[model samples]
Target: MIDKLSWMAIYPEAALLIMACVIALLDLSTTSPRRTATYVLTLLTLAVIAVLTGFNAAAGKTIYGFGGMVVSDPMGNWLKCFATLALMVTLVYGRPYAADRGMLRGGEMFTMSMLALLGMFVMMSGSNFLVLYLGLELLTLSSYALVALRRDNALASEAAMKYFVLGAMASGFLLYGLSMMYGATGSLDINEVFKAIASRQVNHQVLVFGLVFIVAGLAFKVGAAPFHMWVPDVYQGAPTAITLLIGAAPELAAFAIIIRLLVEGLLPLAIDWQQMLTLLAIASLLVGNLAAIAQTNLKRMLAYSTIAQMGFMLLGLVAGVVNGNTYNAQFAYSAAMFYIVTYVLTTLASFGIILLLAREGFESEEITDLAGLNQRSPLYAGVMAIAMFSLAGVPPLVGFYAKFAVLQALIASGQAMHIALAVFAVVMSLIGAFYYLRVVKVMYFDAPLTATTVAAPPDVRAVLTVNGALILILGILPGSLMTLCAQAIVATLAS
Candidate 1:
């Protein structure tokens, strides 16, 4: 058991879970008396755990435990780091948004966020269907609570109810698929399932049925089109802070599950699944991008954009060329990983500013909310512009490099139709840019609605300022990061 525990590697998750429970217990004794303490503890635990986990693991290695239920590998480690950092940023961004609205201490949102993060950690490292299900449930339950953090906001409550019910249905589909796979292969382990697929002749009926449910469930989590009805409403209704966390962290975590299940467990069925992903990629690309043009609410626009962004990510996976004939496979996967990192940074900057700009009783979801931001605050306006441009895939930004890599990979793979689709993605990208740029135009070109300036906390400003700058810096120096992404993905796939 002790030996198994070593492989289980229960340090980071265990520590985070303990910290969350302890903080919740303290909150039971004193309500909102020391939310700052909770925030500080959560940050410290995450930072310490990130460092310790990196130090403990050998890079490019997979450490397995629980009889192959969970395996912490390079992809999981990197994404865990990404998720932890994104969560911390979300906490800081939430501080002013919550404080100004009298909702900072609302139902221990911070504690619930940490718990969701613990679930994400598990999902990122999961190797078996059972472990993935458990982790996803933990994440979902906590997210529901966070969305409903403000008891008085009927909108928040309604959003939470919708999210909860839909999330349950998605989980049911995932579980059904898992059951079918287990029945077919007599294995819950992803690797063992792969082995079964390799040895046994294809069972078209069972395989097709299980594959659809599994991909559908993952698509639901990633906010891919056709399963994306929940995204816009949820983003528009939830507290801005909760919306930020949901936007940045959850989809990336979902990507982890997709990599595990699809690349590992279902690779043999690529002929069957790739077509499905291509259809989804096109649907999401068209719907998410085209629909954003109609949305005046900034968050909802971004929500639809999120679905579109997932389509771009799916494009890379769809172009999964083997490592033969010149490393294109290696390039595509790396580009996808890099795309996630870029999305995290860009989205954080955008949301961080939204938090800073929001007035009391206002969530800053409207483009006009940013009118004459340049006159009000040049620094804020500049940062927001960078985020907007980066999101739009404009040149000299991280977003461009991420998209370029994926496009190159698809084109290289002889998938000309998909390449044409990606080109359409580029055009729709320009269409989507109109909404993002609308905010910028309001900020830089128009007049301010008020004379007094909105105040941003030092910590929040510091983080946003840096992240905003980092996107451009990365855009300039993308080679090293691109190398890291390429190497990490290839190594992960090869492993």
Candidate 2:
């Protein structure tokens, strides 16, 4: 039987699971096309979960439960809080789009997204290999269903099929690697594995081999280069609302799992994984930046941009634990955390504008589709401009500071190789800026294709405005969030 502490550690997750089921059942009784009642309930549930997690994070206590199969820590709780809020914003922005495209027929989208978020929470809290894999499967399965929500759309169906095939392959790789790790260390609990590896008795070759597969699997999850083949196709083919659902909050879960697997569980082998991460980062920057430039489709462009942004985040991971000292580990990992959080904020606004501009029977997908958006609606155009500028790493935007923090961490390592990687990242960012700015130019300079003006529901407008403003506000005052990340990392490390 589970103890009280185990239940406490998972209260928010329990609430989410129960509420999701309730919403699903309640939705069946409603006949409204938009499922307005179900939608409001879902948002309310998410808001409460976000607040609950935020309080738990602020408590700054690390608790392990269920025979140490799971953990609740400041870092995990904070990420969960942010992810919950991000999902709330996503649903708000996505509802109109989903309604227009008839993707909300039975409230599956709402239920599935909540289930997906529950999966993320589990992934973040999991302390055992089996537990993490279980969470990963739950999240991926829900995502596949949500992607295929538009069953009448052939493209959505195709995207779902591709995602399932590729996702299953990646999951297999991760599971096999975890099995190898367990074989080598004789434990599935992360702390036990860490102790076993730190003892240094495991066969080096087998461990390294498992690490290779594990890194490859993680690279795919984060959409890094060489493993990013599915990103562009899925982003372009899925209904835009579904695209945002897949793109936004899932990233935090990915980051949390990486920390759990690599930094927390396998740090004794940092030299090996750090080298692998470096190669992945370099390739991601090169491929993501160059390929994004050639994409005229806006969603595909952002997909590549996500690849490049993740590459930059990986640099921070690469800088951690240099020479096995681990003196710089907290700072480096916190920098990555900050970058990802800010990147998600910027992404929500960018896609919000895209969803807003997409009317019934029209997809604002191509770069040319945004032509003279400023003439049609300056509010949206300005929001889009801020997102683009931030993504381009323009000064006084959060993206710039995110990049700077990562580069600073790299430089602080005082290694010639780390400095050189920082330089390469900088150059890639320069190339990335061109594509990002091209979007801005199209919005401000080109002629409007249609005379219709953009209009948004008040909720979307308010959230989008706040989202865009956060990108700028965080840029101007990044210290608080950066400090919060640092504290969370430090607390996690201490526990």
Candidate 3:
């Protein structure tokens, strides 16, 4: 049933794949010091994709193509647009840092990142089990190479190996679950599977058995505690630039798949999955925040922070279908989406500051490395301070609102356990604030570790400024983005 519209549905993805190949060839042929040609080409490609995606989203029509294996909808389009923007900013903030560390010796970083982005695009659009799994592999394979790009760093190589082994295991869990699902329902299409399950035409026990594995796989992907062993090590060992690449944008893709699998494909099993998510969220918040309090490395601390933040997102998902009614589905899912989007924005600036502080031979991996950052460069310190405060869910910042939205969704569910969950989340967040504020305190109150002035290229500085400003502006006035999320989710569920 492939048609012209099927191809049209994938225009942005097609353009990116072609451009990535062209850029790879151009990088090999050109003899530029900074690989300026490749950099410009990559950014231009991303900008064009972003524009196309925004246009598609604004059109507000849901199109299913490729025999219903791929979907073009407001939710997918908006996530793709933002993911492309995140990649562009990642490259901009990363270039100087990558160049300083000789990571630009080859163009693999740029090409691989572009490919990983393509994977995200596919994941967002996938409406079939096989398509989703394929997309996940593409992204993880590219990320493995990116993490080990340094080749000479033992720690980097070790992190890559660990990520590879664990990622493969998770993929197997997902695949095995998908097979069981297909056997139970006799379909690979997500919508059809949903129909089968919702109609009570499938064996309930088999479906739930398969769902356990699927949830386990997704839990690993999102780095929930008990499955987050690789996060801290990889964040600490991989180059900061690669860590940012892994952290910032792929989260949108992760959220997309969660919706496609759990909500769209298995809503009939909400009571079952929600129970699992509840346990995962509680464990993640408990382990992530408490363990982070002991870390000295900023990256590792942020790694734990990412886990806790993801837990908060899960809270939204768990509250979506209380008492077998989905009247609140859009609100709950939209809150989770908004939280992920804003978290990525703050993360970009947080890691951008770390990347900026690293000089020719100095890596700012330790928290003490930021001691008295205000004395060295008030502007950079201020940006970092804003990011830290925002992540801590402090007042008048986006993080607080993100948490508040999720907690509100949880409390509104009217389940006693959910109300308890909301209270627990607040307490865990209060504990987590200690580490985030510690970073800020060191920046403003401690003595400088070195007298060297913080410096960054104009482009990096410009991006960081915009990133920080957006965090504050969105915090103060979050209506537009929140509305957008609500619209996107409503449109998705309707389709």
Model 1 stretches astray by more than 4 angstroms: 4-8, 28-34, 56-58, 321-327
- Cα error, residue 213 of model 1, in Å, equals 0.8
Candidate 3 accuracy as lDDT: 0.93
Candidate 1 pairs with clashing backbones: none
- Considering summed lDDT, which 10 consecutive residues are worst modelled in model 1? 321-330
lDDT of each: 0.83, 0.94, 0.93
How well is each residue in 275-394 modelled by candidate 1, as lDDT tens digits? 888889889988998899898888888898888888899888887744323356677777888898889889999988888888777777887788898998899899999999988899
Q: Residues 178-203, candidate 2, lDDT per residue (tens digit)?
A: 99999999999999999999999999
Model 1, residue 324: distance off in Å is 11
**Once model 1 is optimally superposed onto the true structure by TM-score, how far is the C-alpha of residue 388 displaced, in angstroms?**
0.6
* Model 3 misplaced regions, further than 4 Å: none
Model 1: how far residue 14 lies from native, Å:
1.4
Would you estimate the TM-scores of all the predictions? 0.95, 0.99, 0.99
Backbone clash tally (model 3): 0
lDDT of 3 by residue, 1-495 (tens): 568989988888999999999999989986776789889989998999999999999999899889999999999999999999999999999898888888888899999999999999999999999999988999999999999998888988998999999999999999999999999999999999999999997889999999999999999899997888888998898999999999999999999999999998999999999999999999999999999999999999999999999999999999999889998899899999999999999999999999999887888989999999999999999999999999999979999899999998998888999999999999999999999999999999999979999878889999999999999999999999999999999998997
- By lDDT, the best candidate is 2
